[model samples]
Target: MRMRTKAVLLIVFLSCLAGCGSREPSAQSPQAASSSHADSGEIVLEADSLKLGQIRTAPVVVQAAPWDEFETPGRVELDPNRVSHVLMPVPGRIRQVLVRLGDAVQEGQPLLIIESPEVSAAVAAYRQAQAELRRAQSALSKAERDLSRIRDLFANRAAAQRDVWAAENEVAQAQAAVEQAKAEQEQARHRLELLGISPNEPVQQISVPAPTSGKVLEIAVAAGEFRTDTSTSLMTIADLSHVWITANVPENLIRLVQIGENVEVELAAYPGEVLRGTVRRIADTLDAETRTVKVQTELPNPSGRLRPGMFGRIRHSHGLKPVAAVPPAALVQDNEGAFVYLEKGRGRFQRRRVRAGQPRNGWAPITEGLSPGERVVVDGAILLSGK
Candidate 1:
C-alpha cells in the first residue's frame, strides 16, 4: 500500500508542475506585451492625431433663380370706395328703417323714411310757391293781351297816351311779379331737395336713399330714434367688392414697401386661402408707439371672405432676383459686424466679415465681402467658436 501511495503522489506532483508551467507563460507573456505597447511612441502620437478636434461642414451654393421671399401680419379694413354712410340731412324721428346692418343697397334706393314736420312744412312752402308762380304767370299773360290792345288803340288814336303808358307799366309790373314768383319757387325746390325729398311738385314723404351702391355697415339710429343734429351719424355703409389690409411694417423695413408692389395676404378666419393684393397706400408717418409704418394693401373681396376687422398677415416681396447668399444660421453676430467661418483649406477655416441684406429663402443676401461657391461652417459654428 505504501509503495502504491508513493507512485500516485509522484504522478500528482508531476501533473501540478505542468499546470504551474502553463500558468507562468500565460501571465508573463501578457505583462511583456503590455510593457512593449507602453514603449511604442508612434501609437501614442497616432492616437493624439486621431483626436484632431471635431469639425462640421456646410456646402456653399449660389442663390438659385426665382427665389421668392416675403413678410407677414395685417388686419382687414373697409374698402373706402365701397363704403358709404346714410345720414339724415334734416333732424326728425326715423319713421321707418327699411334696411339693417350689412344690407346691400343700390344707388338712390330708399333706405329709410324719415317723418319730419320740417320736411312737411318745406313741401307746403314749395307748393305755395308753385301756386304763386302759376297765378303770376296768368296775370302776366292777361296784362300782355291788354298791353297789345292798348298799343293798337293808341296807334289808331282811340286810347289816351296815359292809358297806354299805364298798361305798359302794369305789364312790366306783372312781368316783375312773375320773375319774383319763379325765384321763390326755385328757392322752395332747393329747400326740399336739401331735405332729401324728391323734387316732385307735391311732396308727400321724404325717402332717404343711399347715395352710392354699397353695404350698410352699421345703423346707429333705430326706427324711433331722433336725429337731433348734423353731428349724428344715423347709419354707416361700406362697399365689399374691395377691401384694405392694414399692416404694421417695421420702420427699418419700410423702405422695402412701395406703391404697386404685390402683397400676399392670409387670414386666420380663412385658412389656406391666399388673398392677392397690391400696396396701394403707405402712411407718410410712422407710429411713435410701435415704431412701425402703416401699410395698406388693397385686395379684392369678390367672395366676400375677407371682412373688416378680420386679422391677417401680409407678405411683401422686394422682387426676387439672382443674389449670392447663404443660410442665416451661418451668420454670427460679432462686434466687427455679421460674419461667418469660411473654410480656408483642409481642416482649416478663418473668420470672414460680411455685409448682409434682407433674408430671402432662409438665406441672407451678402451685399459685400462674400462670394458664391465658398464653403462655410453653417452648423457647428458655435463649436468652432469655442476652439
Candidate 2:
C-alpha cells in the first residue's frame, strides 16, 4: 500500500512539471527587451524601455534656408586703375624730396626737385631755336622785297621771266625755313614744359609733380640720389579711398554668383566687423587645378582701413527658400559626420545622415537628407545614438 501511494505522488509532480513547461514564459525586462539593428540603421524598444529612456520627439520644421548661402576665401587687393608710379622724364640727381613716404599729396603738388643737365640743354636749344627763327624771318623779309623788285622789273621788260621765277623760288625757300624754325621752337618749348619748367624762363632745375591725389606708398629716391634711368619708377602712389576684394569660388558655384550682386565681406583680422561690397568682375577662365573661378568685388574704403593682402571671406545669399530644420538636441555629430534620429513610429527610430548648417535661432538648418514634417527624437537622442 505505501509503494502504490508514492507512485501516485510522483506522477502528480511530473504532471505539474509538464504544465509549467507548456505555459508561456514571463515578459523580458526593459533593458533586455531593447534592440538595435546597426546594419539596418534602426532601433526598436519595448514600451517599458521607451518609458525608462524618457525618449521624446518633435516634428521637423520648414524655414528659410540658412544653407542657401555662399562663402569663399578672399583677400584685399589694390585697384590697378588707382595706382600710379612716378617716373622722372629725364636723367637727373634728386636735389630735394618734398614729400616723404606715407605723405598724402594732391595732384600737381611737387614731389621732388631735380638738377638735370637735360633741363639746361632744353633751355639752350630753345634759345637757339628762337635765334634761328629770327634770322629766318629776316631772310624771308629780304626775299619778299627782292621778289617784288623782280616782278616789277619783269613787268617793265627790264628782267627776264626766268629771273622772276628764281626770285619766287628764293621766297618759297625762305618761307619753308621759317616754318621749320617755328616747328623746332615749339618742340623745344614742349620739352621744357614736360620737365615741369616754364618755357619763358631758362632754368637748370625742374620740379617733379604728383600725377594723382594719393598717399606715397614707396620712395626709391632720396634728396641726393642720382637716377640715370628715366624709365624706371622713382616713387609709387595709390588712392586708398577704394579697394578691391577678390575671391576664388568653386566652379560649380560660379553660376550662383553674378556680376553686380551685393555681398558682405569679413576680414580675418577684424572678427566682428562686416563690410559691404559689390560684384565688379568675373574671370572668363577657370583655374584648371583648383576648378575655381576668380571673382572681384569693389568696396568703398573711405576710411582707408582696408589694406592689401589682408585675409578675408566673401559672403553672399541665394535668396530665401524652404529648408528642413531641427532643434540642437536632435543633431548628432561623430567621427563619421553629422546625423539625426528619425522616429519611425511604434517605438522605432532610424539614423539618417545629413548635411547641417551652423545653428541659428535655436535650430539647425538641414541642407541634405532630412525633410519637412518628419519626426525626430529631439530629446534623449544621445541615448538612441549610443545604441
The best candidate in terms of lDDT: 2
lDDT of 2: 0.88
For model 1, residues 1-387, the per-residue Cα lDDT tens digits are 999999999999999999999899888998997797565411211324432345455666567433344475888998676667677777787888999877888888888888777877888888899999999999999999999999999999999999999999999999999999999999999997777776564544577888887788888887887777867677887778889999888888888778998888889998777778988999999899999988999998777777888998887664566667888888999777898888766655677788876554577777677777888877767765754
Instruction: Output the number of the TM-score-best candidate.
Output: 2
Q: Looking at candidate 2, what is the lDDT of residue 353?
A: 92
Clash count, one per candidate? 5, 0
Q: What lDDT, from 0 to 1, does candidate 1 have?
A: 0.79
Global lDDT scores for all candidate models = 0.79, 0.88
Q: What are the runs in model 2 whose C-alpha is more than 4 Å off?
A: 1-32, 36-61, 65-69, 270-274, 325-337, 341-351, 357-365, 373-387
Candidate 2 residue lDDT tens string, 42-151 = 78777777453688898999877643477899999988889999998888889999998999999999999999888988988988999999999999999999999999
User: Can you give the lDDT of residue 305 in candidate 1?
Assistant: 71
Count clashing pairs, candidate 2: 0
In candidate 2, list every pair of residues with a backbone clash: none
The 10-residue segment with the lowest total lDDT in model 2: 27-36
